[model samples]
Target: MAVPRRVVIVGAGLAGASAAGALRERGFDGEILLFGRERHRPYELPALSKEILLGNADEPAWVHDENAYADRDIRLHSATAVERVSLAGHSVLDSEGEEHRYDRLLLATGSHPRALRVPGSDLRGLHLLRTLDDSLALRTALRQAERVVVVGAGWIGCEVAAAARSHGAATTVVDPLPLPLRGSLGDEMGEVFRAVHAEQGVDWRLATAVAGFTGEDQLTGVVLTDGTEIPADMAVVGVGAAPRLGLAEQAGLILTNEVPGGGVAVDSTLRTSDPDVFAAGDIAAPDHPVHGRIRVEHWANAKDQGAHVAGNLLDAGQPYRAEPYFFTDQYELGMEYRGLADPRHDELVVRGDLGAREFIAFWLREGRVQAAMNVNWWDDGDALQALVDRHAEVDARQLRSGDLASLVP
Candidate 1:
């Protein structure tokens, strides 16, 4: 494969910005053009729910400064959305109706917050957290919100609930699930998270769906399916996120909508069906050597996959094998999880103390460690990750031995 003269990257989030930096670092002297739908330059999204919403930070975690991109010779177009992509013509059309040719194209378009289609979703005090501006706007509203209702028990919802309580709001989290984070962490670990939030004075309205919002011009209360109305002045809808794949779909790229990890389907090398075009971040569902085909929306995947695809863009011809990893912070609880495990079916074993919230929990299937999570327990990430990587069969008794090195075999 010949080196491309010009490379165009759509979406100026962490993945796109990381790819641009990796391209320059790997000695790619080609013209790099990065486009974003937001007015601000490329920044990390994790801080939006944590630091920015908590009023501990004023700015989004920028991936690179304005001058840094200029120094690297990367042309960044902020607030310029790529309206369409043409695989046959090898070009893309921006929102301004200008056509730009590219020898190689990378789609890191990321995902957007799933909307609540209830009746009063359009009310004044309803909010959805996704971008930097969304966080800032929600932060301003949270300050004066006396009663806040979060309509999801996922990471974003829990974090936003924590932020609301920090601001002295009577916060309540409502979800259809039986426990918080049950879909991801399963019931066993989800109970731990519920305890953490409950201890922080956050109320839970679980096992019930939201009927709709009640108010004329603004949100006054959240009505549950059982006809119980909880009084609230503010509401945040954070059920989950869906990958942005309109551009890729228009270009006729292969998608895996019927499969588990639905997104633009790519091969082992992160190359889409078109060959010349590639996808990464939350948009790319690549075939994994270890775990089959999967799509991860974590911050670690965006950072790692972006740089990994840069090498393949230069014809490195390597497959993506990075394990799934993510972290969450709410109140006094800080946790990191590695590997992918179906909590519903996997056998869970813990080391240390769950009551004290300082422990390492492992999810295993058929005696092999599938995933590991550490809550308020540091210094075991590398060892735990190694066990998962090796796919080593571990005895439940040995896992609680506090000696992770002995289980590597």
Candidate 2:
């Protein structure tokens, strides 16, 4: 057995960090170099929009401390961004024209904020919350502003709107869609979130589109297509993120498309089209045995995929399959979900109380569990997931009976 000399991982986010740690844990003693574009170390990303936005988190604790990385023998390269990967030569070029060779390379470049094309988007007060710097800028704006307008009623949009409201900012969310989160949770449960935010004092503008900006220098307000003007001290865009795949493409790596949310396609083992290079985190789009090929941007997915990549790197024979999972916190509500629940599902069964602000909605297709949402009642998350995983034809009556133990076969 030939021992590999070096392992290079790009993007020191959750995926890269986990891969490094898992490599050492799995007994890979060769040179392990972790490259991160950001000066800060890899840390958890979920808190940026929720706790960190509310001014309750210390940004320094985002990643593992230097001492911890030292103990793990994980060579940390901070403030260095990989410009390109030379797959044939097995080396990656940094921004400063430096090169680092690797026996195997992992591209975890992740995703970038998707900026809107509407005019006034370049204003100083217009911000997007994806990185620590973005979070800092948005938090400063949230504290200084009395009125805030959030465009795009998606996860980040809703979570930031809730955070702004918590900071005493008069917040209004504008979405062209009929309701928030209709793309993922469907209209049946979107109503529950609408009422939740409404009760928390967030003004909602459904089916409304932004025409342009109002201020000359900074963003003071937004002009809607309906000719309604709403005051805003700052505008935070949370539409979504675009995968950073420029490096992969430049390396002549075969790209995979046709996945939901636009991500690079990889195999079940998390290996990209180039077998020598693997991808994880928000960028790697793997074919789900059940849900087909999908690109997922979730904390749980990163961790699972990272471990899977490590196993495959050690021995190519190992099989890697990831079950996607993610959670969100908004206005005293904790919502968690697992698996792929398509947006086009025709039947949705609601278990528990939607009015009481606590319930689980199961998305089914052909009597199979496609996806599910659990709000404030995570105790039954496993049961619901089981029912979905097994493709069990759950009796609506038995599901709402408050007893899930019987449903688990």
Best model per lDDT: 1
Steric clash pairs (candidate 1): none
**Stretches of candidate 1 above 4 Å error?**
258-261
- Please provide TM-scores, in order, for all candidate models, with all chains considered together: 0.98, 0.95
lDDT against the true structure, per candidate, is 0.93, 0.83
> What lDDT tens digits, residue by residue, belong to model 2 across residues 291-327?
6777888888887787678877765545455456789
- lDDT for each residue of candidate 1 in 128-212, tens digit (9 for 90 to 100): 9999999999999999999999999999999999999999999999999999999889887999999999999999999999999
Output the worst ten-in-a-row residue range by lDDT, candidate 2: 314-323
The backbone clash count of each candidate, in order, is 0, 0
C-alpha-based local distance difference test score of model 2: 0.83
Q: Mark the regions of model 2 whose C-alpha exceeds 4 Å error after superposition.
A: 1-3, 60-63
Candidate 2 colliding pairs: none
In TM-score terms, which candidate is top? Answer: 1
